[model samples]
Target: MSRGSTLAEKIIGRAAGHAVQPGDLAVVAVGMAMSVDSIAPSVIKVMREEFRIPKVADPEKVALFVDHVAPACNVSTAEGQAEVRRFAAEQGIRHLYDVGTGVCHQLMIDRGLARAGEVVLGSDSHSTAYGAIGAFGTGMGATDIALAFATGKTWLRVPETMKVELTGQLPAGVMSKDAILHLIGRLGIDGATYRAVEFYGAEDLTAASRITLCSMTTELGAKAGMIAFPQERLAEFGLPEWLFADPDAGYVHAETIDLAALSPQVSSPDDVDNVSSVDAVVGIHIDQVFLGTCTNGRLEDIHAAARILKGRRVAPHVRMIIIPASDDILKQSVADGSLISLLEAGATVSTPGCGPCIGRHQGVLAAGEACFSTANRNFRGRMGSPEADIYLGSPLTAAATALEGKIADPRNYL
Candidate 1:
């Protein structure tokens, strides 16, 4: 009899052309490999110098991005992006998403580069974002990515699986961002170290919501995050019959969370795991409110914040910034007037990319300041100054914080 295998195992098995189990090391063919501008130079150098490869194994399967420090913050960054562009041109890599196109992960999904039951590797940690669409997405270092680019195959140790099951519907005013933060808090920073987290239930999660859930799973130290994506929704992708975990598969750790019982959750400064209820952290002044990132910068999140900021303007001392996930989402927001509404509410909008989330450019915080950001990851010095602090929350909470200039809860405004 065939042994039951988890989603990660099955997808990997397909890629490796054989059945696999946890702890098995296998070299699998990659469906796609993405590299961001910040690290593309390293990958390019490694491929040329180490492997002496004339070009990547498959140009169609490779992607590059100029998201971090986009728009050329300085001479150094501008030169670095130029190098990436040169390589893409020389290698005929047609998928190089240049500055302001959006975050690499968002563009990958929007462009249909990642699909269900495929193996997508990225140079960015948030490559787990691909899991929202049921892809086996994981991040790798420069050398590994270069090797994959040169050979279209890479070896990986199959990780044990962890099950995160959600039952019941999300309560009023509660966002998927809140649920992830709460889960991360419970599991601690390193809770699921090197583990593949497979989500069950939450069948109604929108594509955007699923992306948020999987993207933030990286905060739990997860190697990959997979949701049993609704098959009907991804019909065009022709997802395999066994995209989900087998019924009899085992889990290293299983956690059950009732979505209906959840409320707005937040992660405090210096650490994503430093979490507490919004009620516990209210009244603390927030100098800035940033509502965008690969985690929560999708259309749904923008709509939620627009609804909150519709008839109100941001508080006097609070600086609100909103950057959509991609140009497509940005255009959609404009067509729907959400962008104007947010701008009218005294919120500043920036180029469609990873704006200020990586402490590089586009809204970096000042010393002694605090920011309420919808982006994942809030470790010390993540956004800007090490002395500054960041509070991670949902779009609703972020809008409320912008209105009240403090760590305010979304429930009150809702």
Candidate 2:
């Protein structure tokens, strides 16, 4: 008799072209390996010195994005981006998304490089964002990414699956950010260490929400996170799937989230797991509101903010910054007038890249400032000064906070 396999085991086994079980070490072919501008220079150097590889094994499957510091914040960052561009050009890498494109994860999905049942690796921690479309995407160190570029293969141990079954409907005022923050609060930051999180009963989740959920799994120490069903646009990738777990699939642990009970949630300053409802923390003043990142920078997120900001202006005391995740999303917002609404609300619209998420030049917080952002992490000093505070929330919450200049419930604005 054969043992039942979880979705993680099934996908890893298929990618490895053999049977695999949890904890089994396997070398599997990779569908894609990517890096952003900040990491690509080191990755390319390692590939040149350590491997001495002449050409990449599959240039078509390798990508580099000039997103982390797109449009070059300074001479140093510009030089880094130039090196990445030179390497991509010399190596014949076909999928390089240069300045003005977008974040690496969004570009991977938009270009069809990441798809269901395929394994994708990136140098950034948020590489797991690709899991939103059912790909087994995870972060890799520079050495592993360099090797993947040279050989198109990477090794890994099959991780156990942790089932997170979300039931009931999300309330109108609450968003995916609230649901994920609620989960993190319940499970803690280290709850699913080194395990694949498989989301079930999320049939109501939109593509944007699913992406947001999967992106934050990294904060919970998950190896990867995924929703079980195929995305509506999955067929466009031309990939095969063994995407579902067996009926009797084994999981290391299982958790159920009742979405009906979750309200608008936020991660308070300096800790992602320190979650509380918006009502609990209301009236705490904010200096800025950032409304974009790989975690929540899609068109849907922009529209959500726009719906609340329509015919309204941000508070005089608050500085609101909005950025789109990709060029396509930016164009969509423009075509649909969401961009105008946001701008009319006194929000500053930046380029289609990682804006202030990395604490780079765009909107770095001054000391003692408090920022409400849609980005994933909220550790101390994550957004510039160690003295500044960061609160992580949904776009709805961020927009509402901008209007009120405080920690405000999006429900009131909705």
lDDT of each: 0.90, 0.88
Write down the TM-score for model 1: 0.97
**Number of colliding residue pairs in each model:** 0, 0
Per-residue alpha-carbon lDDT of candidate 1 for residues 42-149, written as tens digits (9 for 90 to 100): 999999899898789999999999988778899999999999999999999999999889988999999999877888999989999988888999999999999999
Error of 2 at 185 (Å): 1.1
lDDT of 2 by residue, 218-292 (tens): 888888888776334335434454566777888889999898898899899778999998888999999999988
How does residue 351 of candidate 2 score in lDDT?
A: 83
Query: Cα RMSD (Å) per model?
Result: 1.5, 1.9
Count of clashing pairs, candidate 1: 0
Runs in model 1 with CA error above 4 Å? 230-238
The TM-score obtained by model 2 is 0.97
Best by TM-score: 1
Error of 1 at 240 (Å): 2.4
* Candidate 2 ranges with C-alpha deviation above 4 Å: 230-241
Error of 1 at 107 (Å): 0.9
- Find the 10 residues in a row with the least total lDDT in model 1: 229-238
